[model samples]
Target: MKKNILGLLIVSLLLVFVAVNLLTGNEAAPASSLEIQQAESKVEEETVKVNTEVNAEIPYAKDFTLSNLQGEEVSLSDYKGQIVILNFWATWCPPCKEEMPHMQSFYEKQDDIEIVAVNLTSMDVGLEKVKQFVDDYGLTFPVLLDEEDIVGQQYGIITIPTTYIIDQEGRVFQEIVGAVDEQMLEEMINALKSYDE
Candidate 1:
């Protein structure tokens, strides 16, 4: 009887050990997954905060004198009394291409608005390519080339396809990153007009 009782105790101890390990392993998997999700959420939140702060801080237009496709000097000071749409774009970017038509439309609809599409400096490409792109897209607005990228650097442009709406007073009213629609452009224009009045 004593030997039988000792054997039963040994089997019970083995079962308890296995059960404890299984429970701990299951708990650990869920804990790890939760940690990963929390980290992702934090990163997303931080990115949104940074973008908002940057947009709010850089809300004014800076003056620049750059050469146009025709090799003529153009100055932002020339457009001081007009609302200017300063767009920074690259020829290869798809979003930039998409926004071109909308910008053209906006330019056509408004007389007071001045649209200047500044092409970033490119050595891999030449002036002919940019001219061809403008011709193909039917962009009637003056497309300037920042061959030295000086204007880009002065504006702190870290990304392509950036659009800045500058009011008649030369203050930057809005900064848009990536592609934007015609309606958004109209809204901004209207707001600037109201401010001017």
Candidate 2:
């Protein structure tokens, strides 16, 4: 009698497991080609904001001229009619290092947007390190040296890898604080394009 009861319990558990799998099988199934393509093309609307308190009251980015690695003066106003990704970073920062590749990839694919990376020289190692980093990463975007942290202060950069998305009209559209991948950059630019339209 004990053996029979044990057998019945085992069969009941197997039945329950099979029932659950049958109910959830569709979710586990592989997506179709069209479904995969749609998923890849569609950008999901989600919250990507960081340091909201700092950017809440700020409407437009303050124009400032900073010398690039090549010692050429580049100003925020120079990119007024274009979307700008203004990033503040330091040489020793891990996240900043991680983000540079993605930034470079996105910059290469884009023709209308501009990426201005501001190296916080005062907080970073030095000018030589910054140059080495740019060369090692093969970055073509304009890298400005904030030797005195003046631009960093103007942009309210308390953390490394702080990126601000400026609209075509020089409005501060979004402020992302952290490492962002190429997909995230593409989504943000696509959203900005929609907003511009």
Candidate 3:
């Protein structure tokens, strides 16, 4: 009788162990899968939001002339027949850094679109830092230094990464307050091109 009791106890323990392992293992698998699905959903939602924002119209674009990094004078008037994107940024601003690569890529892709990345002068961020940033990011767009903050003040810039898209007729087509994505920049360029036609 004692032997039978021992056998039953061993079987009961084994069954309990199996049940626990299966329950925990099954629960973990679903949780991991759910987490991955949630992450993918979040990414999709963010992409949609960015696309919607890009498609929206811009307000209050303007024109300005400034000197490039090579100390040569450049004028928005010179590009009168082309779409221009004037971006005001500072080297130290995080948002400025985030949007630069996208700007560079847009500049690379578009032939008729002109991008002017104006470095704000009011901030204490030095010229060396700006140069380093331009080099590190491989920015091919014209980088103008606003040494006296003249251009920035003229545009009423209150923050870094303020962008203005100008039409071919020398009028402001859109004004963006912060760092903009490549899609938005492309949309603005397309809009300006349509205006020309």
Tell me model 2's lDDT, rounded to 2 decimals: 0.86
Q: Best-fitting candidate, measured by lDDT? A: 2
By the lDDT metric, which is better: model 1 or model 2? 2
Displacement of residue 46 (Cα, Å) in model 3 is 14
**Per-residue lDDT of 95-128 in model 1, one digit per residue for the tens?**
9889999999989998889998999965317788
lDDT of each residue in 118-178, candidate 3, tens digit only: 8995574788888889999999988988889888888888988888887766667777787
Q: Estimate TM-scores for all models.
A: 0.69, 0.72, 0.67
Tell me the deviation in Å of residue 64 in model 1. Answer: 1.1
Clashing pairs in 2: none
78, model 2: CA deviation in Å? 0.6
Evaluate candidate 3 by giving its C-alpha RMSD to the native, one decimal. 11.2
Higher-scoring candidate on lDDT, 2 or 3: 2
lDDT, residue 186, model 2: 83
lDDT of 1 at 185: 82
